[model samples]
Target: MTSKSGRRVLVADDDEAVRRVVHRHLEDAGYRVESVPSGVEALARLRGAERPDALVTDLQMPGLDGLALLMEAKRLDPALPAIVITAHGSVETAVDAMRKGAYDYVEKPFHKDVLLLTIERALLHRMVLEENLRLTEALAREFSLGNLVGGCAAMQEVFRLAGRAAPTEAPILLLGESGTGKELLARALHYNSARAGKPFVTVNVAAIPESLVESELFGVVKGAFTGAVASRTGLFQQADGGTLFLDEIGEMRIDLQAKLLRTLESGDFRPVGSEREEHADVRIIAATNRDLGTAVEDGAFRRDLYHRIAVVVLRIPPLRDRIEDLPLLLRHFLGKLGAAGLEISSDAMKHLADWHWPGNVRELENELRRAILLRGSTGSIQPGDLSPEIQAGRPPRGRGDGRLDLRAIEIPDEGLNLSDLEREVISKALQKTGGNQTRAAALVGITRQTLIYRMEKHGLK
Candidate 1:
């Protein structure tokens, strides 16, 4: 009765007869089965390189009893489902096992069909858990910090603090401007921690409706309110054993903030319309552009919660402060654009760096994207290709008098003739240099022969 799925099962029992019976039945039912004489051997087998698909063990095994083994096994592999085997009339202990997170339990002297059925259910659960983990990992890829770019002093400090805090279970508070990549830092912390393979959930407090914020954070039970037909788990439960990012925490209403504070303090929360409280094992990482200290003074944010979440605060510097990183950031974005043929001129780069980036890195990326498209076949971005505000912010171009002035040469709407302007500039340069082509060329930062050729072309006798 070998199982075609090639699923593996580990059975541990002190009684040789019981172990042989379970092993034979499971193997005949088309599963690869292994048996251990004691809970100690069962643990060793579970801790081995090849983990079984499911575990079944006796509750009263000598040394490292089934309950302790189940806990240790789950600690090693959270997704591994298990069934506890107990003597008949020991239903109390079986209930305790359930409280401790067992998938199911089978009474001793049970029929072979019953044991097989329990094992099947446990295996199905294990499959579901594995699929959930896979999907969570896929979603986490969106916020991965593997590609974060910056090497400035301010950003280096940020990375240092983030690296120091990632391995611990403490809640982290990220403070920064709107576009300073706070959420990105939070994801870095999660991926670098022990729970990297687990779910990483994000919730924007400002985005969700105030009325539904509680249910959204802690979940909702059926009949909780209007349109509540089915029970739903909240973000906290979904992010259990992983990280939960609370973006824009300062925007949460005061009342709802209190409930959040309780969860942060005790790791226990009650779903809407449910009397029972559930425990969540989630690491919280909250971020906000607003100053929570100001909000606390205004009675908008909870002080206790602030202290709880800000145990290790990391501040992300605004792009303006990290202007030295512009070149690196620019290269990073240009490479991402995949425009192998395009480059940026030095004047265009100066224009980019001079402007105060009120919108931060996000605006810079958007501007670069627009420039890449608008460049067309030009092959390089110039000062004129940038927005009018950016061009207006450029350093003043010098006048013929050798004085810097704000007044720039303006062309009429119909556009001035380029030949007329070039001829006028050459005649004036020759007059200023006493008709000497060398001094005139030096004045205009060009070679003497180029100046003579321009003079002849303009018919400047």
Candidate 2:
């Protein structure tokens, strides 16, 4: 089985038999378990270069107790899940553990199955909660730039930029093609930045009309224009201390660009009819699917404002450039959809991964969702289940086959061939590593189920 922790666990229990039992059980469960006698040694392991995903410790250890370890663990990483095992009548210590964020505790004589299940569930729950917190923290990461989606060296650079840009107050300029996720990156930048708590205001410059743009942006004073009966504020004022994203800046009217520049420069604006100036503290981020340099040369954009907003410029690659990410994205999306009870077939997935998605990720997701519904079963989704449009966009042959295809990646020909591969790989890797999917995936440079699918594929009993 694959380790839910994906890392080692530190077990601090003085009982020799109990220690051996835990070490063997967790090791069988695919965790690299390190058992130690005292809380002091466990704390030493944690504070040193070696870190555990979770800690299972017994209360009332000599000198340094489990309660002290819990405090230190919380200080190190608050989300680190801990399971406290205690002797009976230690109700006070158990209650204290919960109050200080020890996830939950089990009695000293806890069953082996109970301990393993508790550890697995606690770790998985912690992972989900951390992911949510990260999502909330990363609202400003400009996901468009990082959309390439691979752990490849080239892809790491893109992710690095996204991480750095997520927390800044500076305006981020995303330059990319129409299908390259410029807007997604813009949203990431907002969610991960200082203004993440505030609203992210977006305006498509190309979508608005030149005549009504001024009134739309600055709002109208009472009797400011033909339809102006009352006063109102605009999007810029509404986005104070937050982010205002202007997409397709090249298409903005030059006159309107001047007013926008004024607001960016001095944070001051006046209603269409009002002579008084109102101040707005808004951070401006801009995106364009076109060449802004060419637009600037042609006098379609002001050079000064371009420098102000382009303080952080990120160029996103097209889907064709980072096609290696297709498989990982495939696994992530398929796993997610499967959890939601939609089983996508390998052939259908092959068609998807091999296709030239001109519409990029958005198109791939739509097709997969449609395939799920069309199949109308929790069983596998096959090539026949896909829309004709997806089948038509297939990439060149051998695109989906990697170097380790035989062991980690499955090929869907027809009939029951796909599951055959899955079963074969899972069975062999389990046998070879004694049922450890995590190490097998590492050996193959792919995921655990990828190996499992091959085990089932080849029927390697």
Candidate 3:
């Protein structure tokens, strides 16, 4: 018998002998027991400032019966765990009491051990419920919109759009570079929405093999395929009444994109090899790193599907564009990585700011982790603690006068075309780098894919 020393139990019965017997049993089992002869008096004690942890009441009370008392008690504290005591012939009433919100029912002439065990189980159930609630609240706070760290104008705009759109049922498309926090934003939206208590399922489209993508999203009936052995629930069904975050949506196969589009439009999808169609009320939040408009133009992505998921598009800017947020992000990551006490030297901070983070925030966090490990016994991180690429930094793009060193180019009286200027800069970068797209992209401070897109747009060789 586990000693429930401080646990308080309230016992109510119309019979004086029953109350005394129950009180003595509960007290002997190490519980602080309070006995009342009527449900009315028990209700009064429940309504008082100090409430017991569990309730035990007899079903046939005078004015307020056990069933009524149980309902009222649950109404006052929705999570209150109540157990009802009933006579041997009142098994049906005990069942009714359970339906009215009693945790369990104990028939008359029950052994003391039986009563104590039921109380123990009821308290355990209440403990589990409280723990789950605490965890849910903590997750809500962690993913709250206000908790996302960003102070730059670009991030502020992103936050503003997310705040306004989070409460809506419209489909959302997140566009950004690979390392931008698109998935984090998606979670924040889901956790803040009306369906916060429901599931939030995520699927990385690019990660799954092409052969399994369809079945993974829409599920499979048992024996639907050669080796599906058991019936499987898909991401869409699992996220019913909640959210489905499709990561790397651009990488989804064209055939599967059509299926995804159909599901989004109709909210009905047939599991692979299944004759019947299943309906799931799920909100879609898709994310991608590719330039979808270009993909649609190139006939790679379906235009109809693009429009469906892009009802509300939010673009997360790359780290380079929001350099001012570096300090805030550094502190945020350090605290998250459990190195909150570690400090960064001015030289190290300068290197971090200067480096063009192709991998964005994800890379920055990884770099911080590495630096923390290399910081050794030193309380502060120095420039040498950073990666070599970051230590080398980028060649100065600005002059001592705090202006871009574009003095080599002169604007003629007629003025030059900006497009021509852009083309020339890109072409020169490619020519200077021996047509190596990666190096050329680095010289131009753009992603290799972006450089290729521009080169194709300019009809560059």
Candidate 4:
């Protein structure tokens, strides 16, 4: 739908003079323009399919007040960018309008470029958001429901919920502890969705800077900022026909939370510096390690945004909780690591089966790779070749002093789940050493290859 040209512009102001001024200014700036006197007229025009890329409306109008009109326009298409005109220092109203879904606000009597700049940024922002979702859905892995990895009953339930929820168009939120593979669940949802072939964009909301997160997600035109030397697209636009994964979304700043809520509702946004609206067909998949409910109660996160993004909540359990599949996981990792063709010593194997791994699958992989690396040119791994920490009967992890890394487990005298216990040990040991399988193996007095083998055996990852 993109052509080598400018974007659509909608002007809604009762002041004929102001409308004419804005219309001419935007047209001269290389945009197609349509002007209406009031919000009601703007809505009628939009409903008629004369959708504009952006709308510039005055706060006060004869009918369908600007705020109400803006809300209605968004209801028509959240992607339709808009800017509100307000009196100077009336930022409180502008902020309220933003909370109500306006793209941005411009004080009355501002320079033409100021208004133009706001619209440009808004349009570009929408473009990037769509693009981000486009990439995410298009590039998502083919993760079937059965391929969710764990066989534990808890995981099985998770898989079931994920599969059941995949086909729907509603937003999905995945909640879990750190390192619990929330992103994987999100990818699974996208890949299994109807828009699987489109883009699938991921934005670690916590990772992006507060100052730049908007432009980075929405898109930015040339000179949108001090360092923006050229035009750039945001994640939203890139994910136009796909899914957008907002990871660690709970970490986003409070100010940006309102903007996100509007976009989630409207599905459109502008770039960093443009007076145009960018459209996209996007789905959202948000994941977080923090408890959003708590954050909302604490006033750290917006309530509206939470409800918008959490239509379908999937909880990812920690590795320790599902230890029954340790063996399966260990074998999977071992095969992937190419650690086959090596004989395992019963002594080493037992040691691995008994140790605690804290790093989860990632940690297990580290330990296994380290062990394999120790195999040298001969590719023959031996327990004696293990790292000194492991050889000294310490966890593969580095020690600063007295960190309670792995707590040795006491196999119950009456009864205990052997498979589960072994996986827990493997997970803890790995976590202690930060997933250094080789060192972990050595500390447990086994070869790194043996650790991998054990991780595989236990499905510990």
* lDDT per residue (tens digit) for residues 251-300 in model 4: 67677788778777887788888889787678999987666776676566
Question: What are the RMSDs of all candidates, in order?
Answer: 17.8, 24.3, 7.3, 15.9
Error of 2 at 332 (Å): 3.4
Best by lDDT: 3
Number of backbone collisions per candidate, in order? 5, 40, 0, 91
Model 2 spans with C-alpha error above 4 angstroms: 1-154, 335-344, 376-378, 394-461
Native-referenced Cα lDDT, model 4: 0.76
What is candidate 1's CA lDDT for residue 37? 92
Candidate 4 structure, TM-score to reference: 0.53
lDDT value for candidate 3? 0.88
| Candidate 1 weakest lDDT stretch, 10 residues | 395-404
lDDT of each residue in 1-461, candidate 3, tens digit only: 33498999999998999999999999988899999999899999999999999999998988998888999999998888999998999999888878878899998899998998999999999988888778767878999999998999889999999999999999999999878899999999998888787889999986787788899999998988788898898999999999999998877767888999999999999998899999999999999877788767756688999999999999999898999999999999999999898899998998999887878899899999999988767779999899877787753333121225788867889988998988999999989989987668656655444576678888997
Cα shift from native, residue 450, model 3 (Å): 16
**Best-first order by TM-score:** 3, 1, 4, 2
Instruction: Write one digit per residue (lDDT tens) for candidate 2, span 1-461.
Output: 32555677889988888889888989888888899999889988888787888899888788789999899988987878899988989978888998998988988777889998888888887878777767655643434335435665655775688779768777778876556667766777777676776777888865776666777677778898777788888888888888888887766666777898888889999878989888888888798766667556646577888888898888876665677777676665666566454556777767866766766666666766777667754577788887765677643453431234348755457546655554555566567777665556444444333344445546553
